[model samples]
Target: MTERLMNTLETPCLIIDAQRMDRNIQVMADMARNHQVNLRPHAKTHKIPAIALQQIEAGAVGITVAKIAEAEVMAAHGIRDIFIAYPLVTASKIERAIRLSQRIELIVGVDSLAGAQLLEQIAGRHGHSLQVRLEIDTGLRRTGVLYDQAAALAAEIAGMPHLRLTGIYTFRGSLLAGKPTLDIAAAGKEEGTLMVQLAERLRAQGIAISDVSVGSTPTAAYAAAVEGVTEVRPGTYVFHDRMQARLGACDLEDCAGSVLVTVVSRPSAELAIVDGGSKTFATDIQPGTEPLQLRGFGHILELEDATLARLTEEHGMIELGPQAQAANLRIGDKLRIIPNHICSTVNLHNHVVMQRDQAYKRLPVLARGMLE
Candidate 1:
């Protein structure tokens, strides 16, 4: 059967274009290889072993996860090297981390001495050493230590008998405030350079800094050029969302994923409701950028372009201009939506159907809701 024929069998399901996905992966991999930076794409985007293996085969050094359960899923699939970008503090989670370290080469992020001490004790009791990376709060004031304090944390981790200081990592996501693509890139490069400088300072202070990881899809293209950054861990680039497009980091054509929903009802002359609501397209809003007023949860892809629109729980409210609304959009017709944030929308589904021209396949979202 043709791909469209098969797609009719799966309604309200995510359909991934395999060819497009492969192309996106190759583009990023080629970029990293050409720039001579290690590529460790975050697996949290797809959260499927099949996609993860595809990335690995395309030359990913390893995979980055946000939770211990995600690491466990990746490890079960024989992903030998995994890095949990977030810090693990609880005793049960620390024990789980220690156990996972025995099976795979694991690296956990640390920002505090207390967290380091807890992990060190767990590693000591388990008779195995843990690899720890100090997270530097370059610009994103999330879960990272200040650059000056990074060296101190590195020193503490280095002194712990059961923990080994491997490198420094940072997420330059704070650069995505507006459409300042060049400014964001410059800021990211500066932050990465400072991170490398701090790493060098740690080395001079008798601390061994092996890896310097920096990433943010908005900043990946430029951050890779930073001198001291050894690896780039961009995750959202794989599925370029509307936000990425607005930031000029990717073209709309580079978006490989979309929500397939049917027009359910048109109760007014100026508005139409789509079957996809908050449950399908997610309620995440993309901030407006000059030259493009983005005011909704997603952009409706027209034949040649797209328009911004809002989403409700069970319906999508699209405000159509006179010429745009005049186009005959009958009930039961399907439309594709480029989500504002691909990662958040993806986590809402259980499986993603794959298609390319006339071929079709189905893949389970193996790591959905593994956020513990």
Candidate 2:
């Protein structure tokens, strides 16, 4: 589409290039197939059931979500197989999971024995048997049982009456020895090796460990190549972000999502203000981090020399480079910005504009705020 056409559309809206997105989906699907592992792309990134169905049609065996509410939304939209890759610790959430299991094939992630026992109690009351995956901390250190205690915890969870322990999974980025590293290949190899070894040990103890699920977008292919890994859960690859590009996961052109905002002001010669701001783009991945060293909130597609330096609630501050001044950015001029993190940035919008064949269509972000 031309700049004139983009300017005609409303400001501060997400624009997704359908063709680029489909290619990303196909590439990841083929990568999982090539490595002989099931592709279970995490729906937490897109959160739209329609995209989840598209992923399923492209060879994904199932989808992974972060919240029970997200799973509920997807299940309501005809998605049958799902993995709630989060620990449900409360009676209400566990009861909801039990209810969902009756209608779909659900796999819940359990890191603590207490969480599993609660699930067991709720499912038993409902006369249901729930399948579960033990979350092992292969090194992210966010949630999940530590590497040393996984075997013992797995044994305990397996003994529960209503919960069946079928697999082990982890979500770790490029890390070496529990510290972030730039060598994604090595990090992915180690992640796969650790999970596979633990699965073998669990099997030796008479536990039925069928699945060794692992991998993020950066490490999916590398981790999937390991001998015993059965599934991979990669979410961000469907809509590549600036962080993913810097991590070497995808090229800049591979990114399909961008916020279309209009230039609302020019306070100074080098400073240009946009309609979208902190509320518009995600700030989780800060400008300066060790490995990636990302320097901006988002990347401006039209002006390569301009930097999105700052963001308030409703304003994006763009610092123009000396060479970019010739472009003469004026008020009402539209700019396309690829955010640092697409997943969080997506949640902020009520709907997104899908651009296909030079045409635009609005689709509601159905699961945008299903945080519970």
Among the numbered candidates, top lDDT falls to: 2
Clashes of each: 0, 0
**Alpha carbon lDDT at 28, candidate 2:** 98
Model 2 poorest ten-residue lDDT run: 173-182
CA lDDT, candidate 2, residue 9: 88
Name the runs in model 1 displaced over 4 angstroms.
Answer: 1-3, 6-9, 174-182, 287-293, 303-308
Residue 231 error, candidate 1, Å: 0.3
In the range 1-372, model 1's lDDT, one tens digit per residue, is 243653475456676777778888998899889879899989888898778888989999999999999999988988988999998999899999888988888999988998888988888888888998988887556788876777767887899998888888988753443333445577667757877889889899988898989877777767888887789898888878877787777888888888877777878766667777788875555436443346677767772332436666767776667765767677776777778888888888898877777766778889989989
lDDT of each: 0.79, 0.91
TM-score of model 1 vs. true structure: 0.93
* lDDT for each residue of candidate 2 in 27-133, tens digit (9 for 90 to 100): 99999999989999998788899999999999999999999999999999999999999999999989888889989999999999888888888888888899999
Misplaced by over 4 Å in model 2 are: 175-177
